[model samples]
Target: MKSPRVLLCVRQNTLRWDGEPSSLCCSSCCVLRCFDDRAAAARVNQHAHGRGTRTSLVRHGDPRVRLIAAHRSPLTALFSARGLQQITRQQQSPATQRRMRQQVSSEPQGVAEDILHLSAWLARQPHLPPVDDLLLDRFLYNCKYSLSRCKSVLDMYYTVRTAVPEFFKHRDATEDSIRRSCEVTLAAALPRLTPAGHRVFVHRLLDADSRRFDLLAHSRRVFMLVDVLLHTEPVLGAVVVLDLHASTWAHVLRAPPPLLRRLAVCFQDSCPIAIKEIHFVNAPGFIRKFLDIIRPLLKKKLNERVHVHTGGLETVGKSLPLHMLPKEYGGEEKSLKELSDAWQLALERRRDWFKAEELKRVDESLRPGAAPERAQLFGVEGSFQRLAVD
Candidate 1:
């Protein structure tokens, strides 16, 4: 095994950093060297943390130049981590940027540095799409600031997006069928977080007529609500409410197996939303039968988190704030009609944003493999069941 080498390329004789002393270089204010002890890499990364700083530190074996930068070497892949920070600032307003900076500053040391490193790693992956730091920051928080888990989640996220195109693509909210799905199921992220600081999302069956339902359209609308919720709300996790008051067999039987399999794939592993608890209320006898049929398909951890209420909203009310819930569910909040309408309007306003996100799916053709592994993901039948139970 060879020692890790750090190579630096500078454009000046003296290097300066904010609140730090200058270090002298050589040969027209430029210096390039590869070392074995790896002492220089730590200092290089420390200086690279300064704003608007430019320095190339590449690791190679046996003291060789392994693509430091365009100036010193042929590889231009080594980008300043400042690029990621600039993206975060450009996307947010002055107020939001300041807020984010303050939040990061309050965290333990090296949090921001790890986020920048995560963004840099994503940049090097040829198959992945670009993501803003805001989203990455939330994902880091979701993973408890663990870089390895964050990377795995992001990888599955984009890969699953490609494999499950039906839910992710064509997310325009103005379509008639999509619009109907919204009205049929009163779905929205409740305005108030639970006592534990988890966002509360509720789904109720408004239109009892099962014949009017389209599984695909309903699934798409549900995910749309979820996407907007996770992006806008800040919470420790999420608590899902499924109120199945008037659902019938017609609605349950209409869901196809393939679609259920895809939904399971995205919801189970692809999504970054951490579901704290799932509560079922106003459930009927047949609903249990449906759950029994699909029970074997769910993961054990998820199955353990599920709760079927035998009483009223009191059980759910204990989990969520009463004043923030819909009045129908025994809370002091607005009625489901009011909350759903507000969310529907919000979704309409974000139609353009959702359309833009549809283009973020991975291009499997360009993936560096003989063939993408997507076919095997959805190829098995009866391996998945629908959590989209109305």
Candidate 2:
């Protein structure tokens, strides 16, 4: 590689061209040499003046110029290294410029390694919330010392702190409050969390919060967001690290027909539009029955021109009203079974077994995907058997 350029100045009369001091060129003051041969004198002059090239060191009235002394030959030299230093001192602030030069020289060499070490440090921190008030304390300390690291750590602190509640699902909280928590925590913890530790700690904290809200209810919009998150989870673990439960998707799909249909309509206009496919995967068995019950109503709305398309029929699980089952049967105790059973027995005398397909969507594929899956039924035969045992 080419060396970096630096201007050099030789002091006057330093004609040590052959590594020896000559009478024509002394340690100080101008000197000259004369040759008996004119051609030799010209060659000597050219060599002394560096082949007629105007070196940057050349300046008007510089001591290196040959004085009109009868020394028989022209001599030349420029300022020395110490002289160059003196000149630089005149042009720069001693303390400030030196410091700036030092910084410029060191930054380029340190930058890449700094980034690597910083990232590694952030990765090692435990991902737990400050059980006390330590987060803001550490951040303030970092801001005072490691300013750049502080900014990065603060940004992460805010993002994870804010996203925590949203992903975990709890009672309603404002985005502003979440944002504030991040700011406060970062102010305390920036000094404490190394970059690697910061990243890992944030993740662990989020994981803990995620576990706390193991059972989360999604709003219609958030239900749609779940699909988007799931799609991008593989390549980058950040999206997937929150440990999303399969049941969360199931809950979204099992929303009532009206809610699920509304979400589907909203999803149609969202970016990528592919999130709609996630709804099918999240569908639950109860939602299937719910759709069966609402399909005729949706068809009637379509026939009357009150709605454009009968959309909810595709989500059969939404129709199941499984929430009506008591807590003993894995439901929210919504009592839909009691009401439906009462209605069924009320029309018992005029029972119709005709709507087999309509009443139960027992497709062959649904019978058992891998093993023999049993469908728990509350039909008359099952009820009669229970009554006899009682």
What digit string (tens of lDDT, one per residue) describes model 2 on residues 1-390? 311111111244233222122322332222222113444334334545764433333233333332121111111112111122111111123443343234223231132244344445434432322211122222322232243544344433322223233332332222344333222211010011111111000101112132322222333113322222222111001110111112233333444444433332222211121211111222334445544543443323232321111222122133223342233224453232332232223222222321221222212232113311121111122221100100
* Model 1 stretches astray by more than 4 angstroms: 1-108, 384-390
Error in Å for residue 355 of model 1: 1.5
Using Cα atoms with residue i matched to residue i, what is each candidate's TM-score against the true structure?
0.69, 0.16
Judge candidate 2 against the unseen true structure and give its global Cα lDDT, from 0 to 1. 0.25
Which whole-number lDDT from 0 to 100 does residue 194 have in model 2? 15
Number of the top TM-score candidate? 1
- Give the per-residue Cα lDDT of candidate 1 at 368: 57
